[model samples]
Target: MRVSVDTDRCCSSGQCVAAVPEVFDQDEDEGLVLLLDAEPPVQRQASVRLAAGICPGRAITIHEE
Candidate 1:
């Protein structure tokens, strides 16, 4: 699974970070979504997907390969 975040569309809600801190974070200064792991392990896929789905700005994207 691959995860990507569009910072431009982020609202700094931190939902992604809250959902999966292992794969996502929020910039302290900019308050934008940060992609910690572009390619997270399979074990983290469910959390990643949840984060993406709950993102208020719809800034998260996921790809499975």
Candidate 2:
């Protein structure tokens, strides 16, 4: 699985970070979505997908390979 977040469309919402802290985080200055890991542990895939779904800005995208 791969994860990607569009910074341009992101609104600094912390939902992704809250849902998948292992794969997502916030920039100290902007508080936007910061991808900590693209290929996270297998245990985190569901949470990452959940985060993408809950993102109001629709900035999160997940790909399964």
Candidate 3:
């Protein structure tokens, strides 16, 4: 799966980072959601989806390949 984040829409809740640190992170300077892995491994797909769903700002998006 491919993951994306919209910093413009991000509320910096850090929920995505908490759900899947392997695929998401919070920027140190702005505390915005960061896409650590645009394309994460299969083992991390489920958590990636979870992170997208739990994102308060709905900034996380997933495209399955």
Candidate 4:
């Protein structure tokens, strides 16, 4: 699984980080979504998909392999 985030579209809601802190984070300076793991471990795939789906700004994208 692959994950990416669009900071330009982020609303800084931190939903992604809350859903999957292992794969996402928030910038302290800007509070924008940060991709901690572009390619997270298999165990984290489910939460990653959840994060992408719940992102209020639609800033998260997932590529399944």
- lDDT values for all models: 0.91, 0.90, 0.87, 0.91
Q: Which lDDT tens digits does candidate 2 get at residues 1-65? A: 98888999999879998998888899999898899999888988889889999999999988889
| Cα lDDT tens digits for candidate 3, 1-65 | 77788999999999888888877888999999978889999898988888888888889888887
Flag clash pairs in model 4: none
Best first by TM-score, ranked: 1, 4, 2, 3
TM, every model: 0.95, 0.93, 0.93, 0.95
Tens digit of lDDT per residue, candidate 1, span 1-65? 88778888999999999999999888999999889899999899998999999999999999888
Clashes per prediction?
0, 0, 0, 0
TM accuracy, model 2: 0.93
Candidate 4 per-residue lDDT over residues 1-65, each given as its tens digit = 87878999999999998998988999999999989899999899988988999998999989877
Pairs that clash in candidate 2: none
Q: Which stretches of candidate 1 lie over 4 Å from their true place?
A: none
Q: Rank the candidates by lDDT, best first.
A: 1, 4, 2, 3
In model 2, state the lDDT of residue 31: 91
| Model 1: how far residue 6 lies from native, Å | 0.4
